[model samples]
Target: MLKMLLLFLIGAAVSIDLIAGQACQPRSANPGRACKKACTHDAQCRGRLKTCQCDNVCGMSCFNPNLACNDPGPFPNGQISPERGYGQVIRYTCNVGYNLRFGNNRTCQSNKQWSGVQPRCDREYWHFFIILFYMGEDL
Candidate 1:
């Protein structure tokens, strides 16, 4: 009985990634309590919390949680919501003479990285109008 109990306890501890057997979830999903364990090193955590470390405490850090991306360009405009943090979402738009050539929205993933292609402002082609004008000239 004693040996069985000890084995169970050890297994339980090892299976959980958080400290004190507490649940570790995203900050947005779990409020008030620390959904993640504080860490003193990178190996102890994964995903957005991978580089977790708080003053070498082994568990207490989430320092660099935000993610950044390069600018899309000029004339066309776009914006990233909560731009400086993890789980951010970006939306893009174009001016009167431009069209969006890529996905309009992207999300910052749990790995502290952005997901989806960066949007581009492509110049619109008025080929239909040109074709119609040529046809009229021929007529």
Candidate 2:
């Protein structure tokens, strides 16, 4: 049992190393380690891109907006995509017993910001209360 466990551990370590090597072939350091020491000799890490590391990860990122207790979806009752990135479009809808307060389908812009006003999901009961409170004040 001890020998088997040791073998398994060794195999896991080797597998992880192999995977890491392949994933980060440019240098052992992660892509986030931009401008850091990638090699003992500077020349080994030279001549890639301007500002080699520069946080240029494989994919674009978007600032996912707050859903305000609403279920984010692509349509009024559709499901939300698990993945988000640059140029990805997102639409949101309130869950049952709730209403969409504001906002519309928005796109993840190239600047990594979501386009359009942030949306809110307000519970139906609370929304009624809000309207009543405003009406009462006006009266």
Candidate 3:
């Protein structure tokens, strides 16, 4: 009787471990790191991480505007497209009185990419003269 009880306990422990392991494992479709949980829609699975938890099963993450919000696509800088995708890049320029603090241009990497950090458009005091000239103002 003692041996039988010990065996039953061992079996229960192994079964629990197996279930836990499966839950932690990532789905085959998503070869990347495991997301928080399984997702049901694309809204739940968007962004660089690209994973979501929806139905409880490990599934793809959708883009959730409410959860992970971002700037609307991209805007044109001069003649360049700020769209996010391969071979696309975004350029930025400051107004007449301002200057770009960072690189004026950013590119999309092989992996779908966006600006890791938003660039700043600094104010150029020297250019203030130019604006004043155009406006026909003094001081």
Candidate 4:
């Protein structure tokens, strides 16, 4: 049992190291690292024309937006489309009993940002109080 537990601990450490090694670990000490995509980031990229990607060895750098768009990550109470690429139309759908407020679909544009605004997955009961409060007005 002791040997098995030790082996498991070593295995877990190895797994963690391997995972972290494969990721884009940021290197801040050396600013002179010459990479093709240098100084690229959502903030560093100017004029909304360039993209801030981290594929370069010098960490996140600015470069022209790629044809394949990156995933927009998580939504609070909604699900975003799985497909991510240029010209691909993504859909935003709210979970059951929730209302999708704003844009439902967005095209992956040339710029890094998605076209138009994303939807807010609002709860069905969320508006009840506001509507009741505004009952006196002609809403």
Which digits, one per residue and each the tens of the lDDT, describe model 4 over residues 1-139?
9999999877543322131254344534564334444442366667566665543224555555456766776778889888777557889999887988887987764444566676788889857877887986874
lDDT of 1 by residue, 1-139 (tens): 9999998877554333344344333223323223345554567666763555321212244445544544433434434334534545667677666778767776554334456666777766786688788988954
- Top lDDT prediction, candidate number: 4
- Which digits, one per residue and each the tens of the lDDT, describe model 3 over residues 1-139? 9999998877543322131243223334653334343444345544764533221222333333234223324332323334555324576666555556656666543223343455666655777687778799654
Which clashing pairs does model 2 show? none
User: Model 2, 1-139: lDDT tens per residue?
Assistant: 9999999877544322231232222332343322333332223444443122211231211222221222233344333444355445776756787667566466654335455666766556877798889988955
Candidate 3 segments whose C-alpha is farther than 4 A from its true place:
1-80, 115-117, 127-139
- Sort every candidate by lDDT, greatest first: 4, 1, 3, 2
Winner by TM-score between candidate 3 and candidate 1: 1
Q: Can you rank all candidates by TM-score, best first?
A: 4, 1, 2, 3
Off by over 4 Å in 2: 1-80, 126-139
Answer with 1 or 2, whichever has the higher lDDT: 1
lDDT of 2 at 95: 71
Q: Could you tell me how far off, in angstroms, the CA of residue 25 lies in candidate 2 after the best superposition?
A: 40
Better of 3 and 4 by TM-score: 4
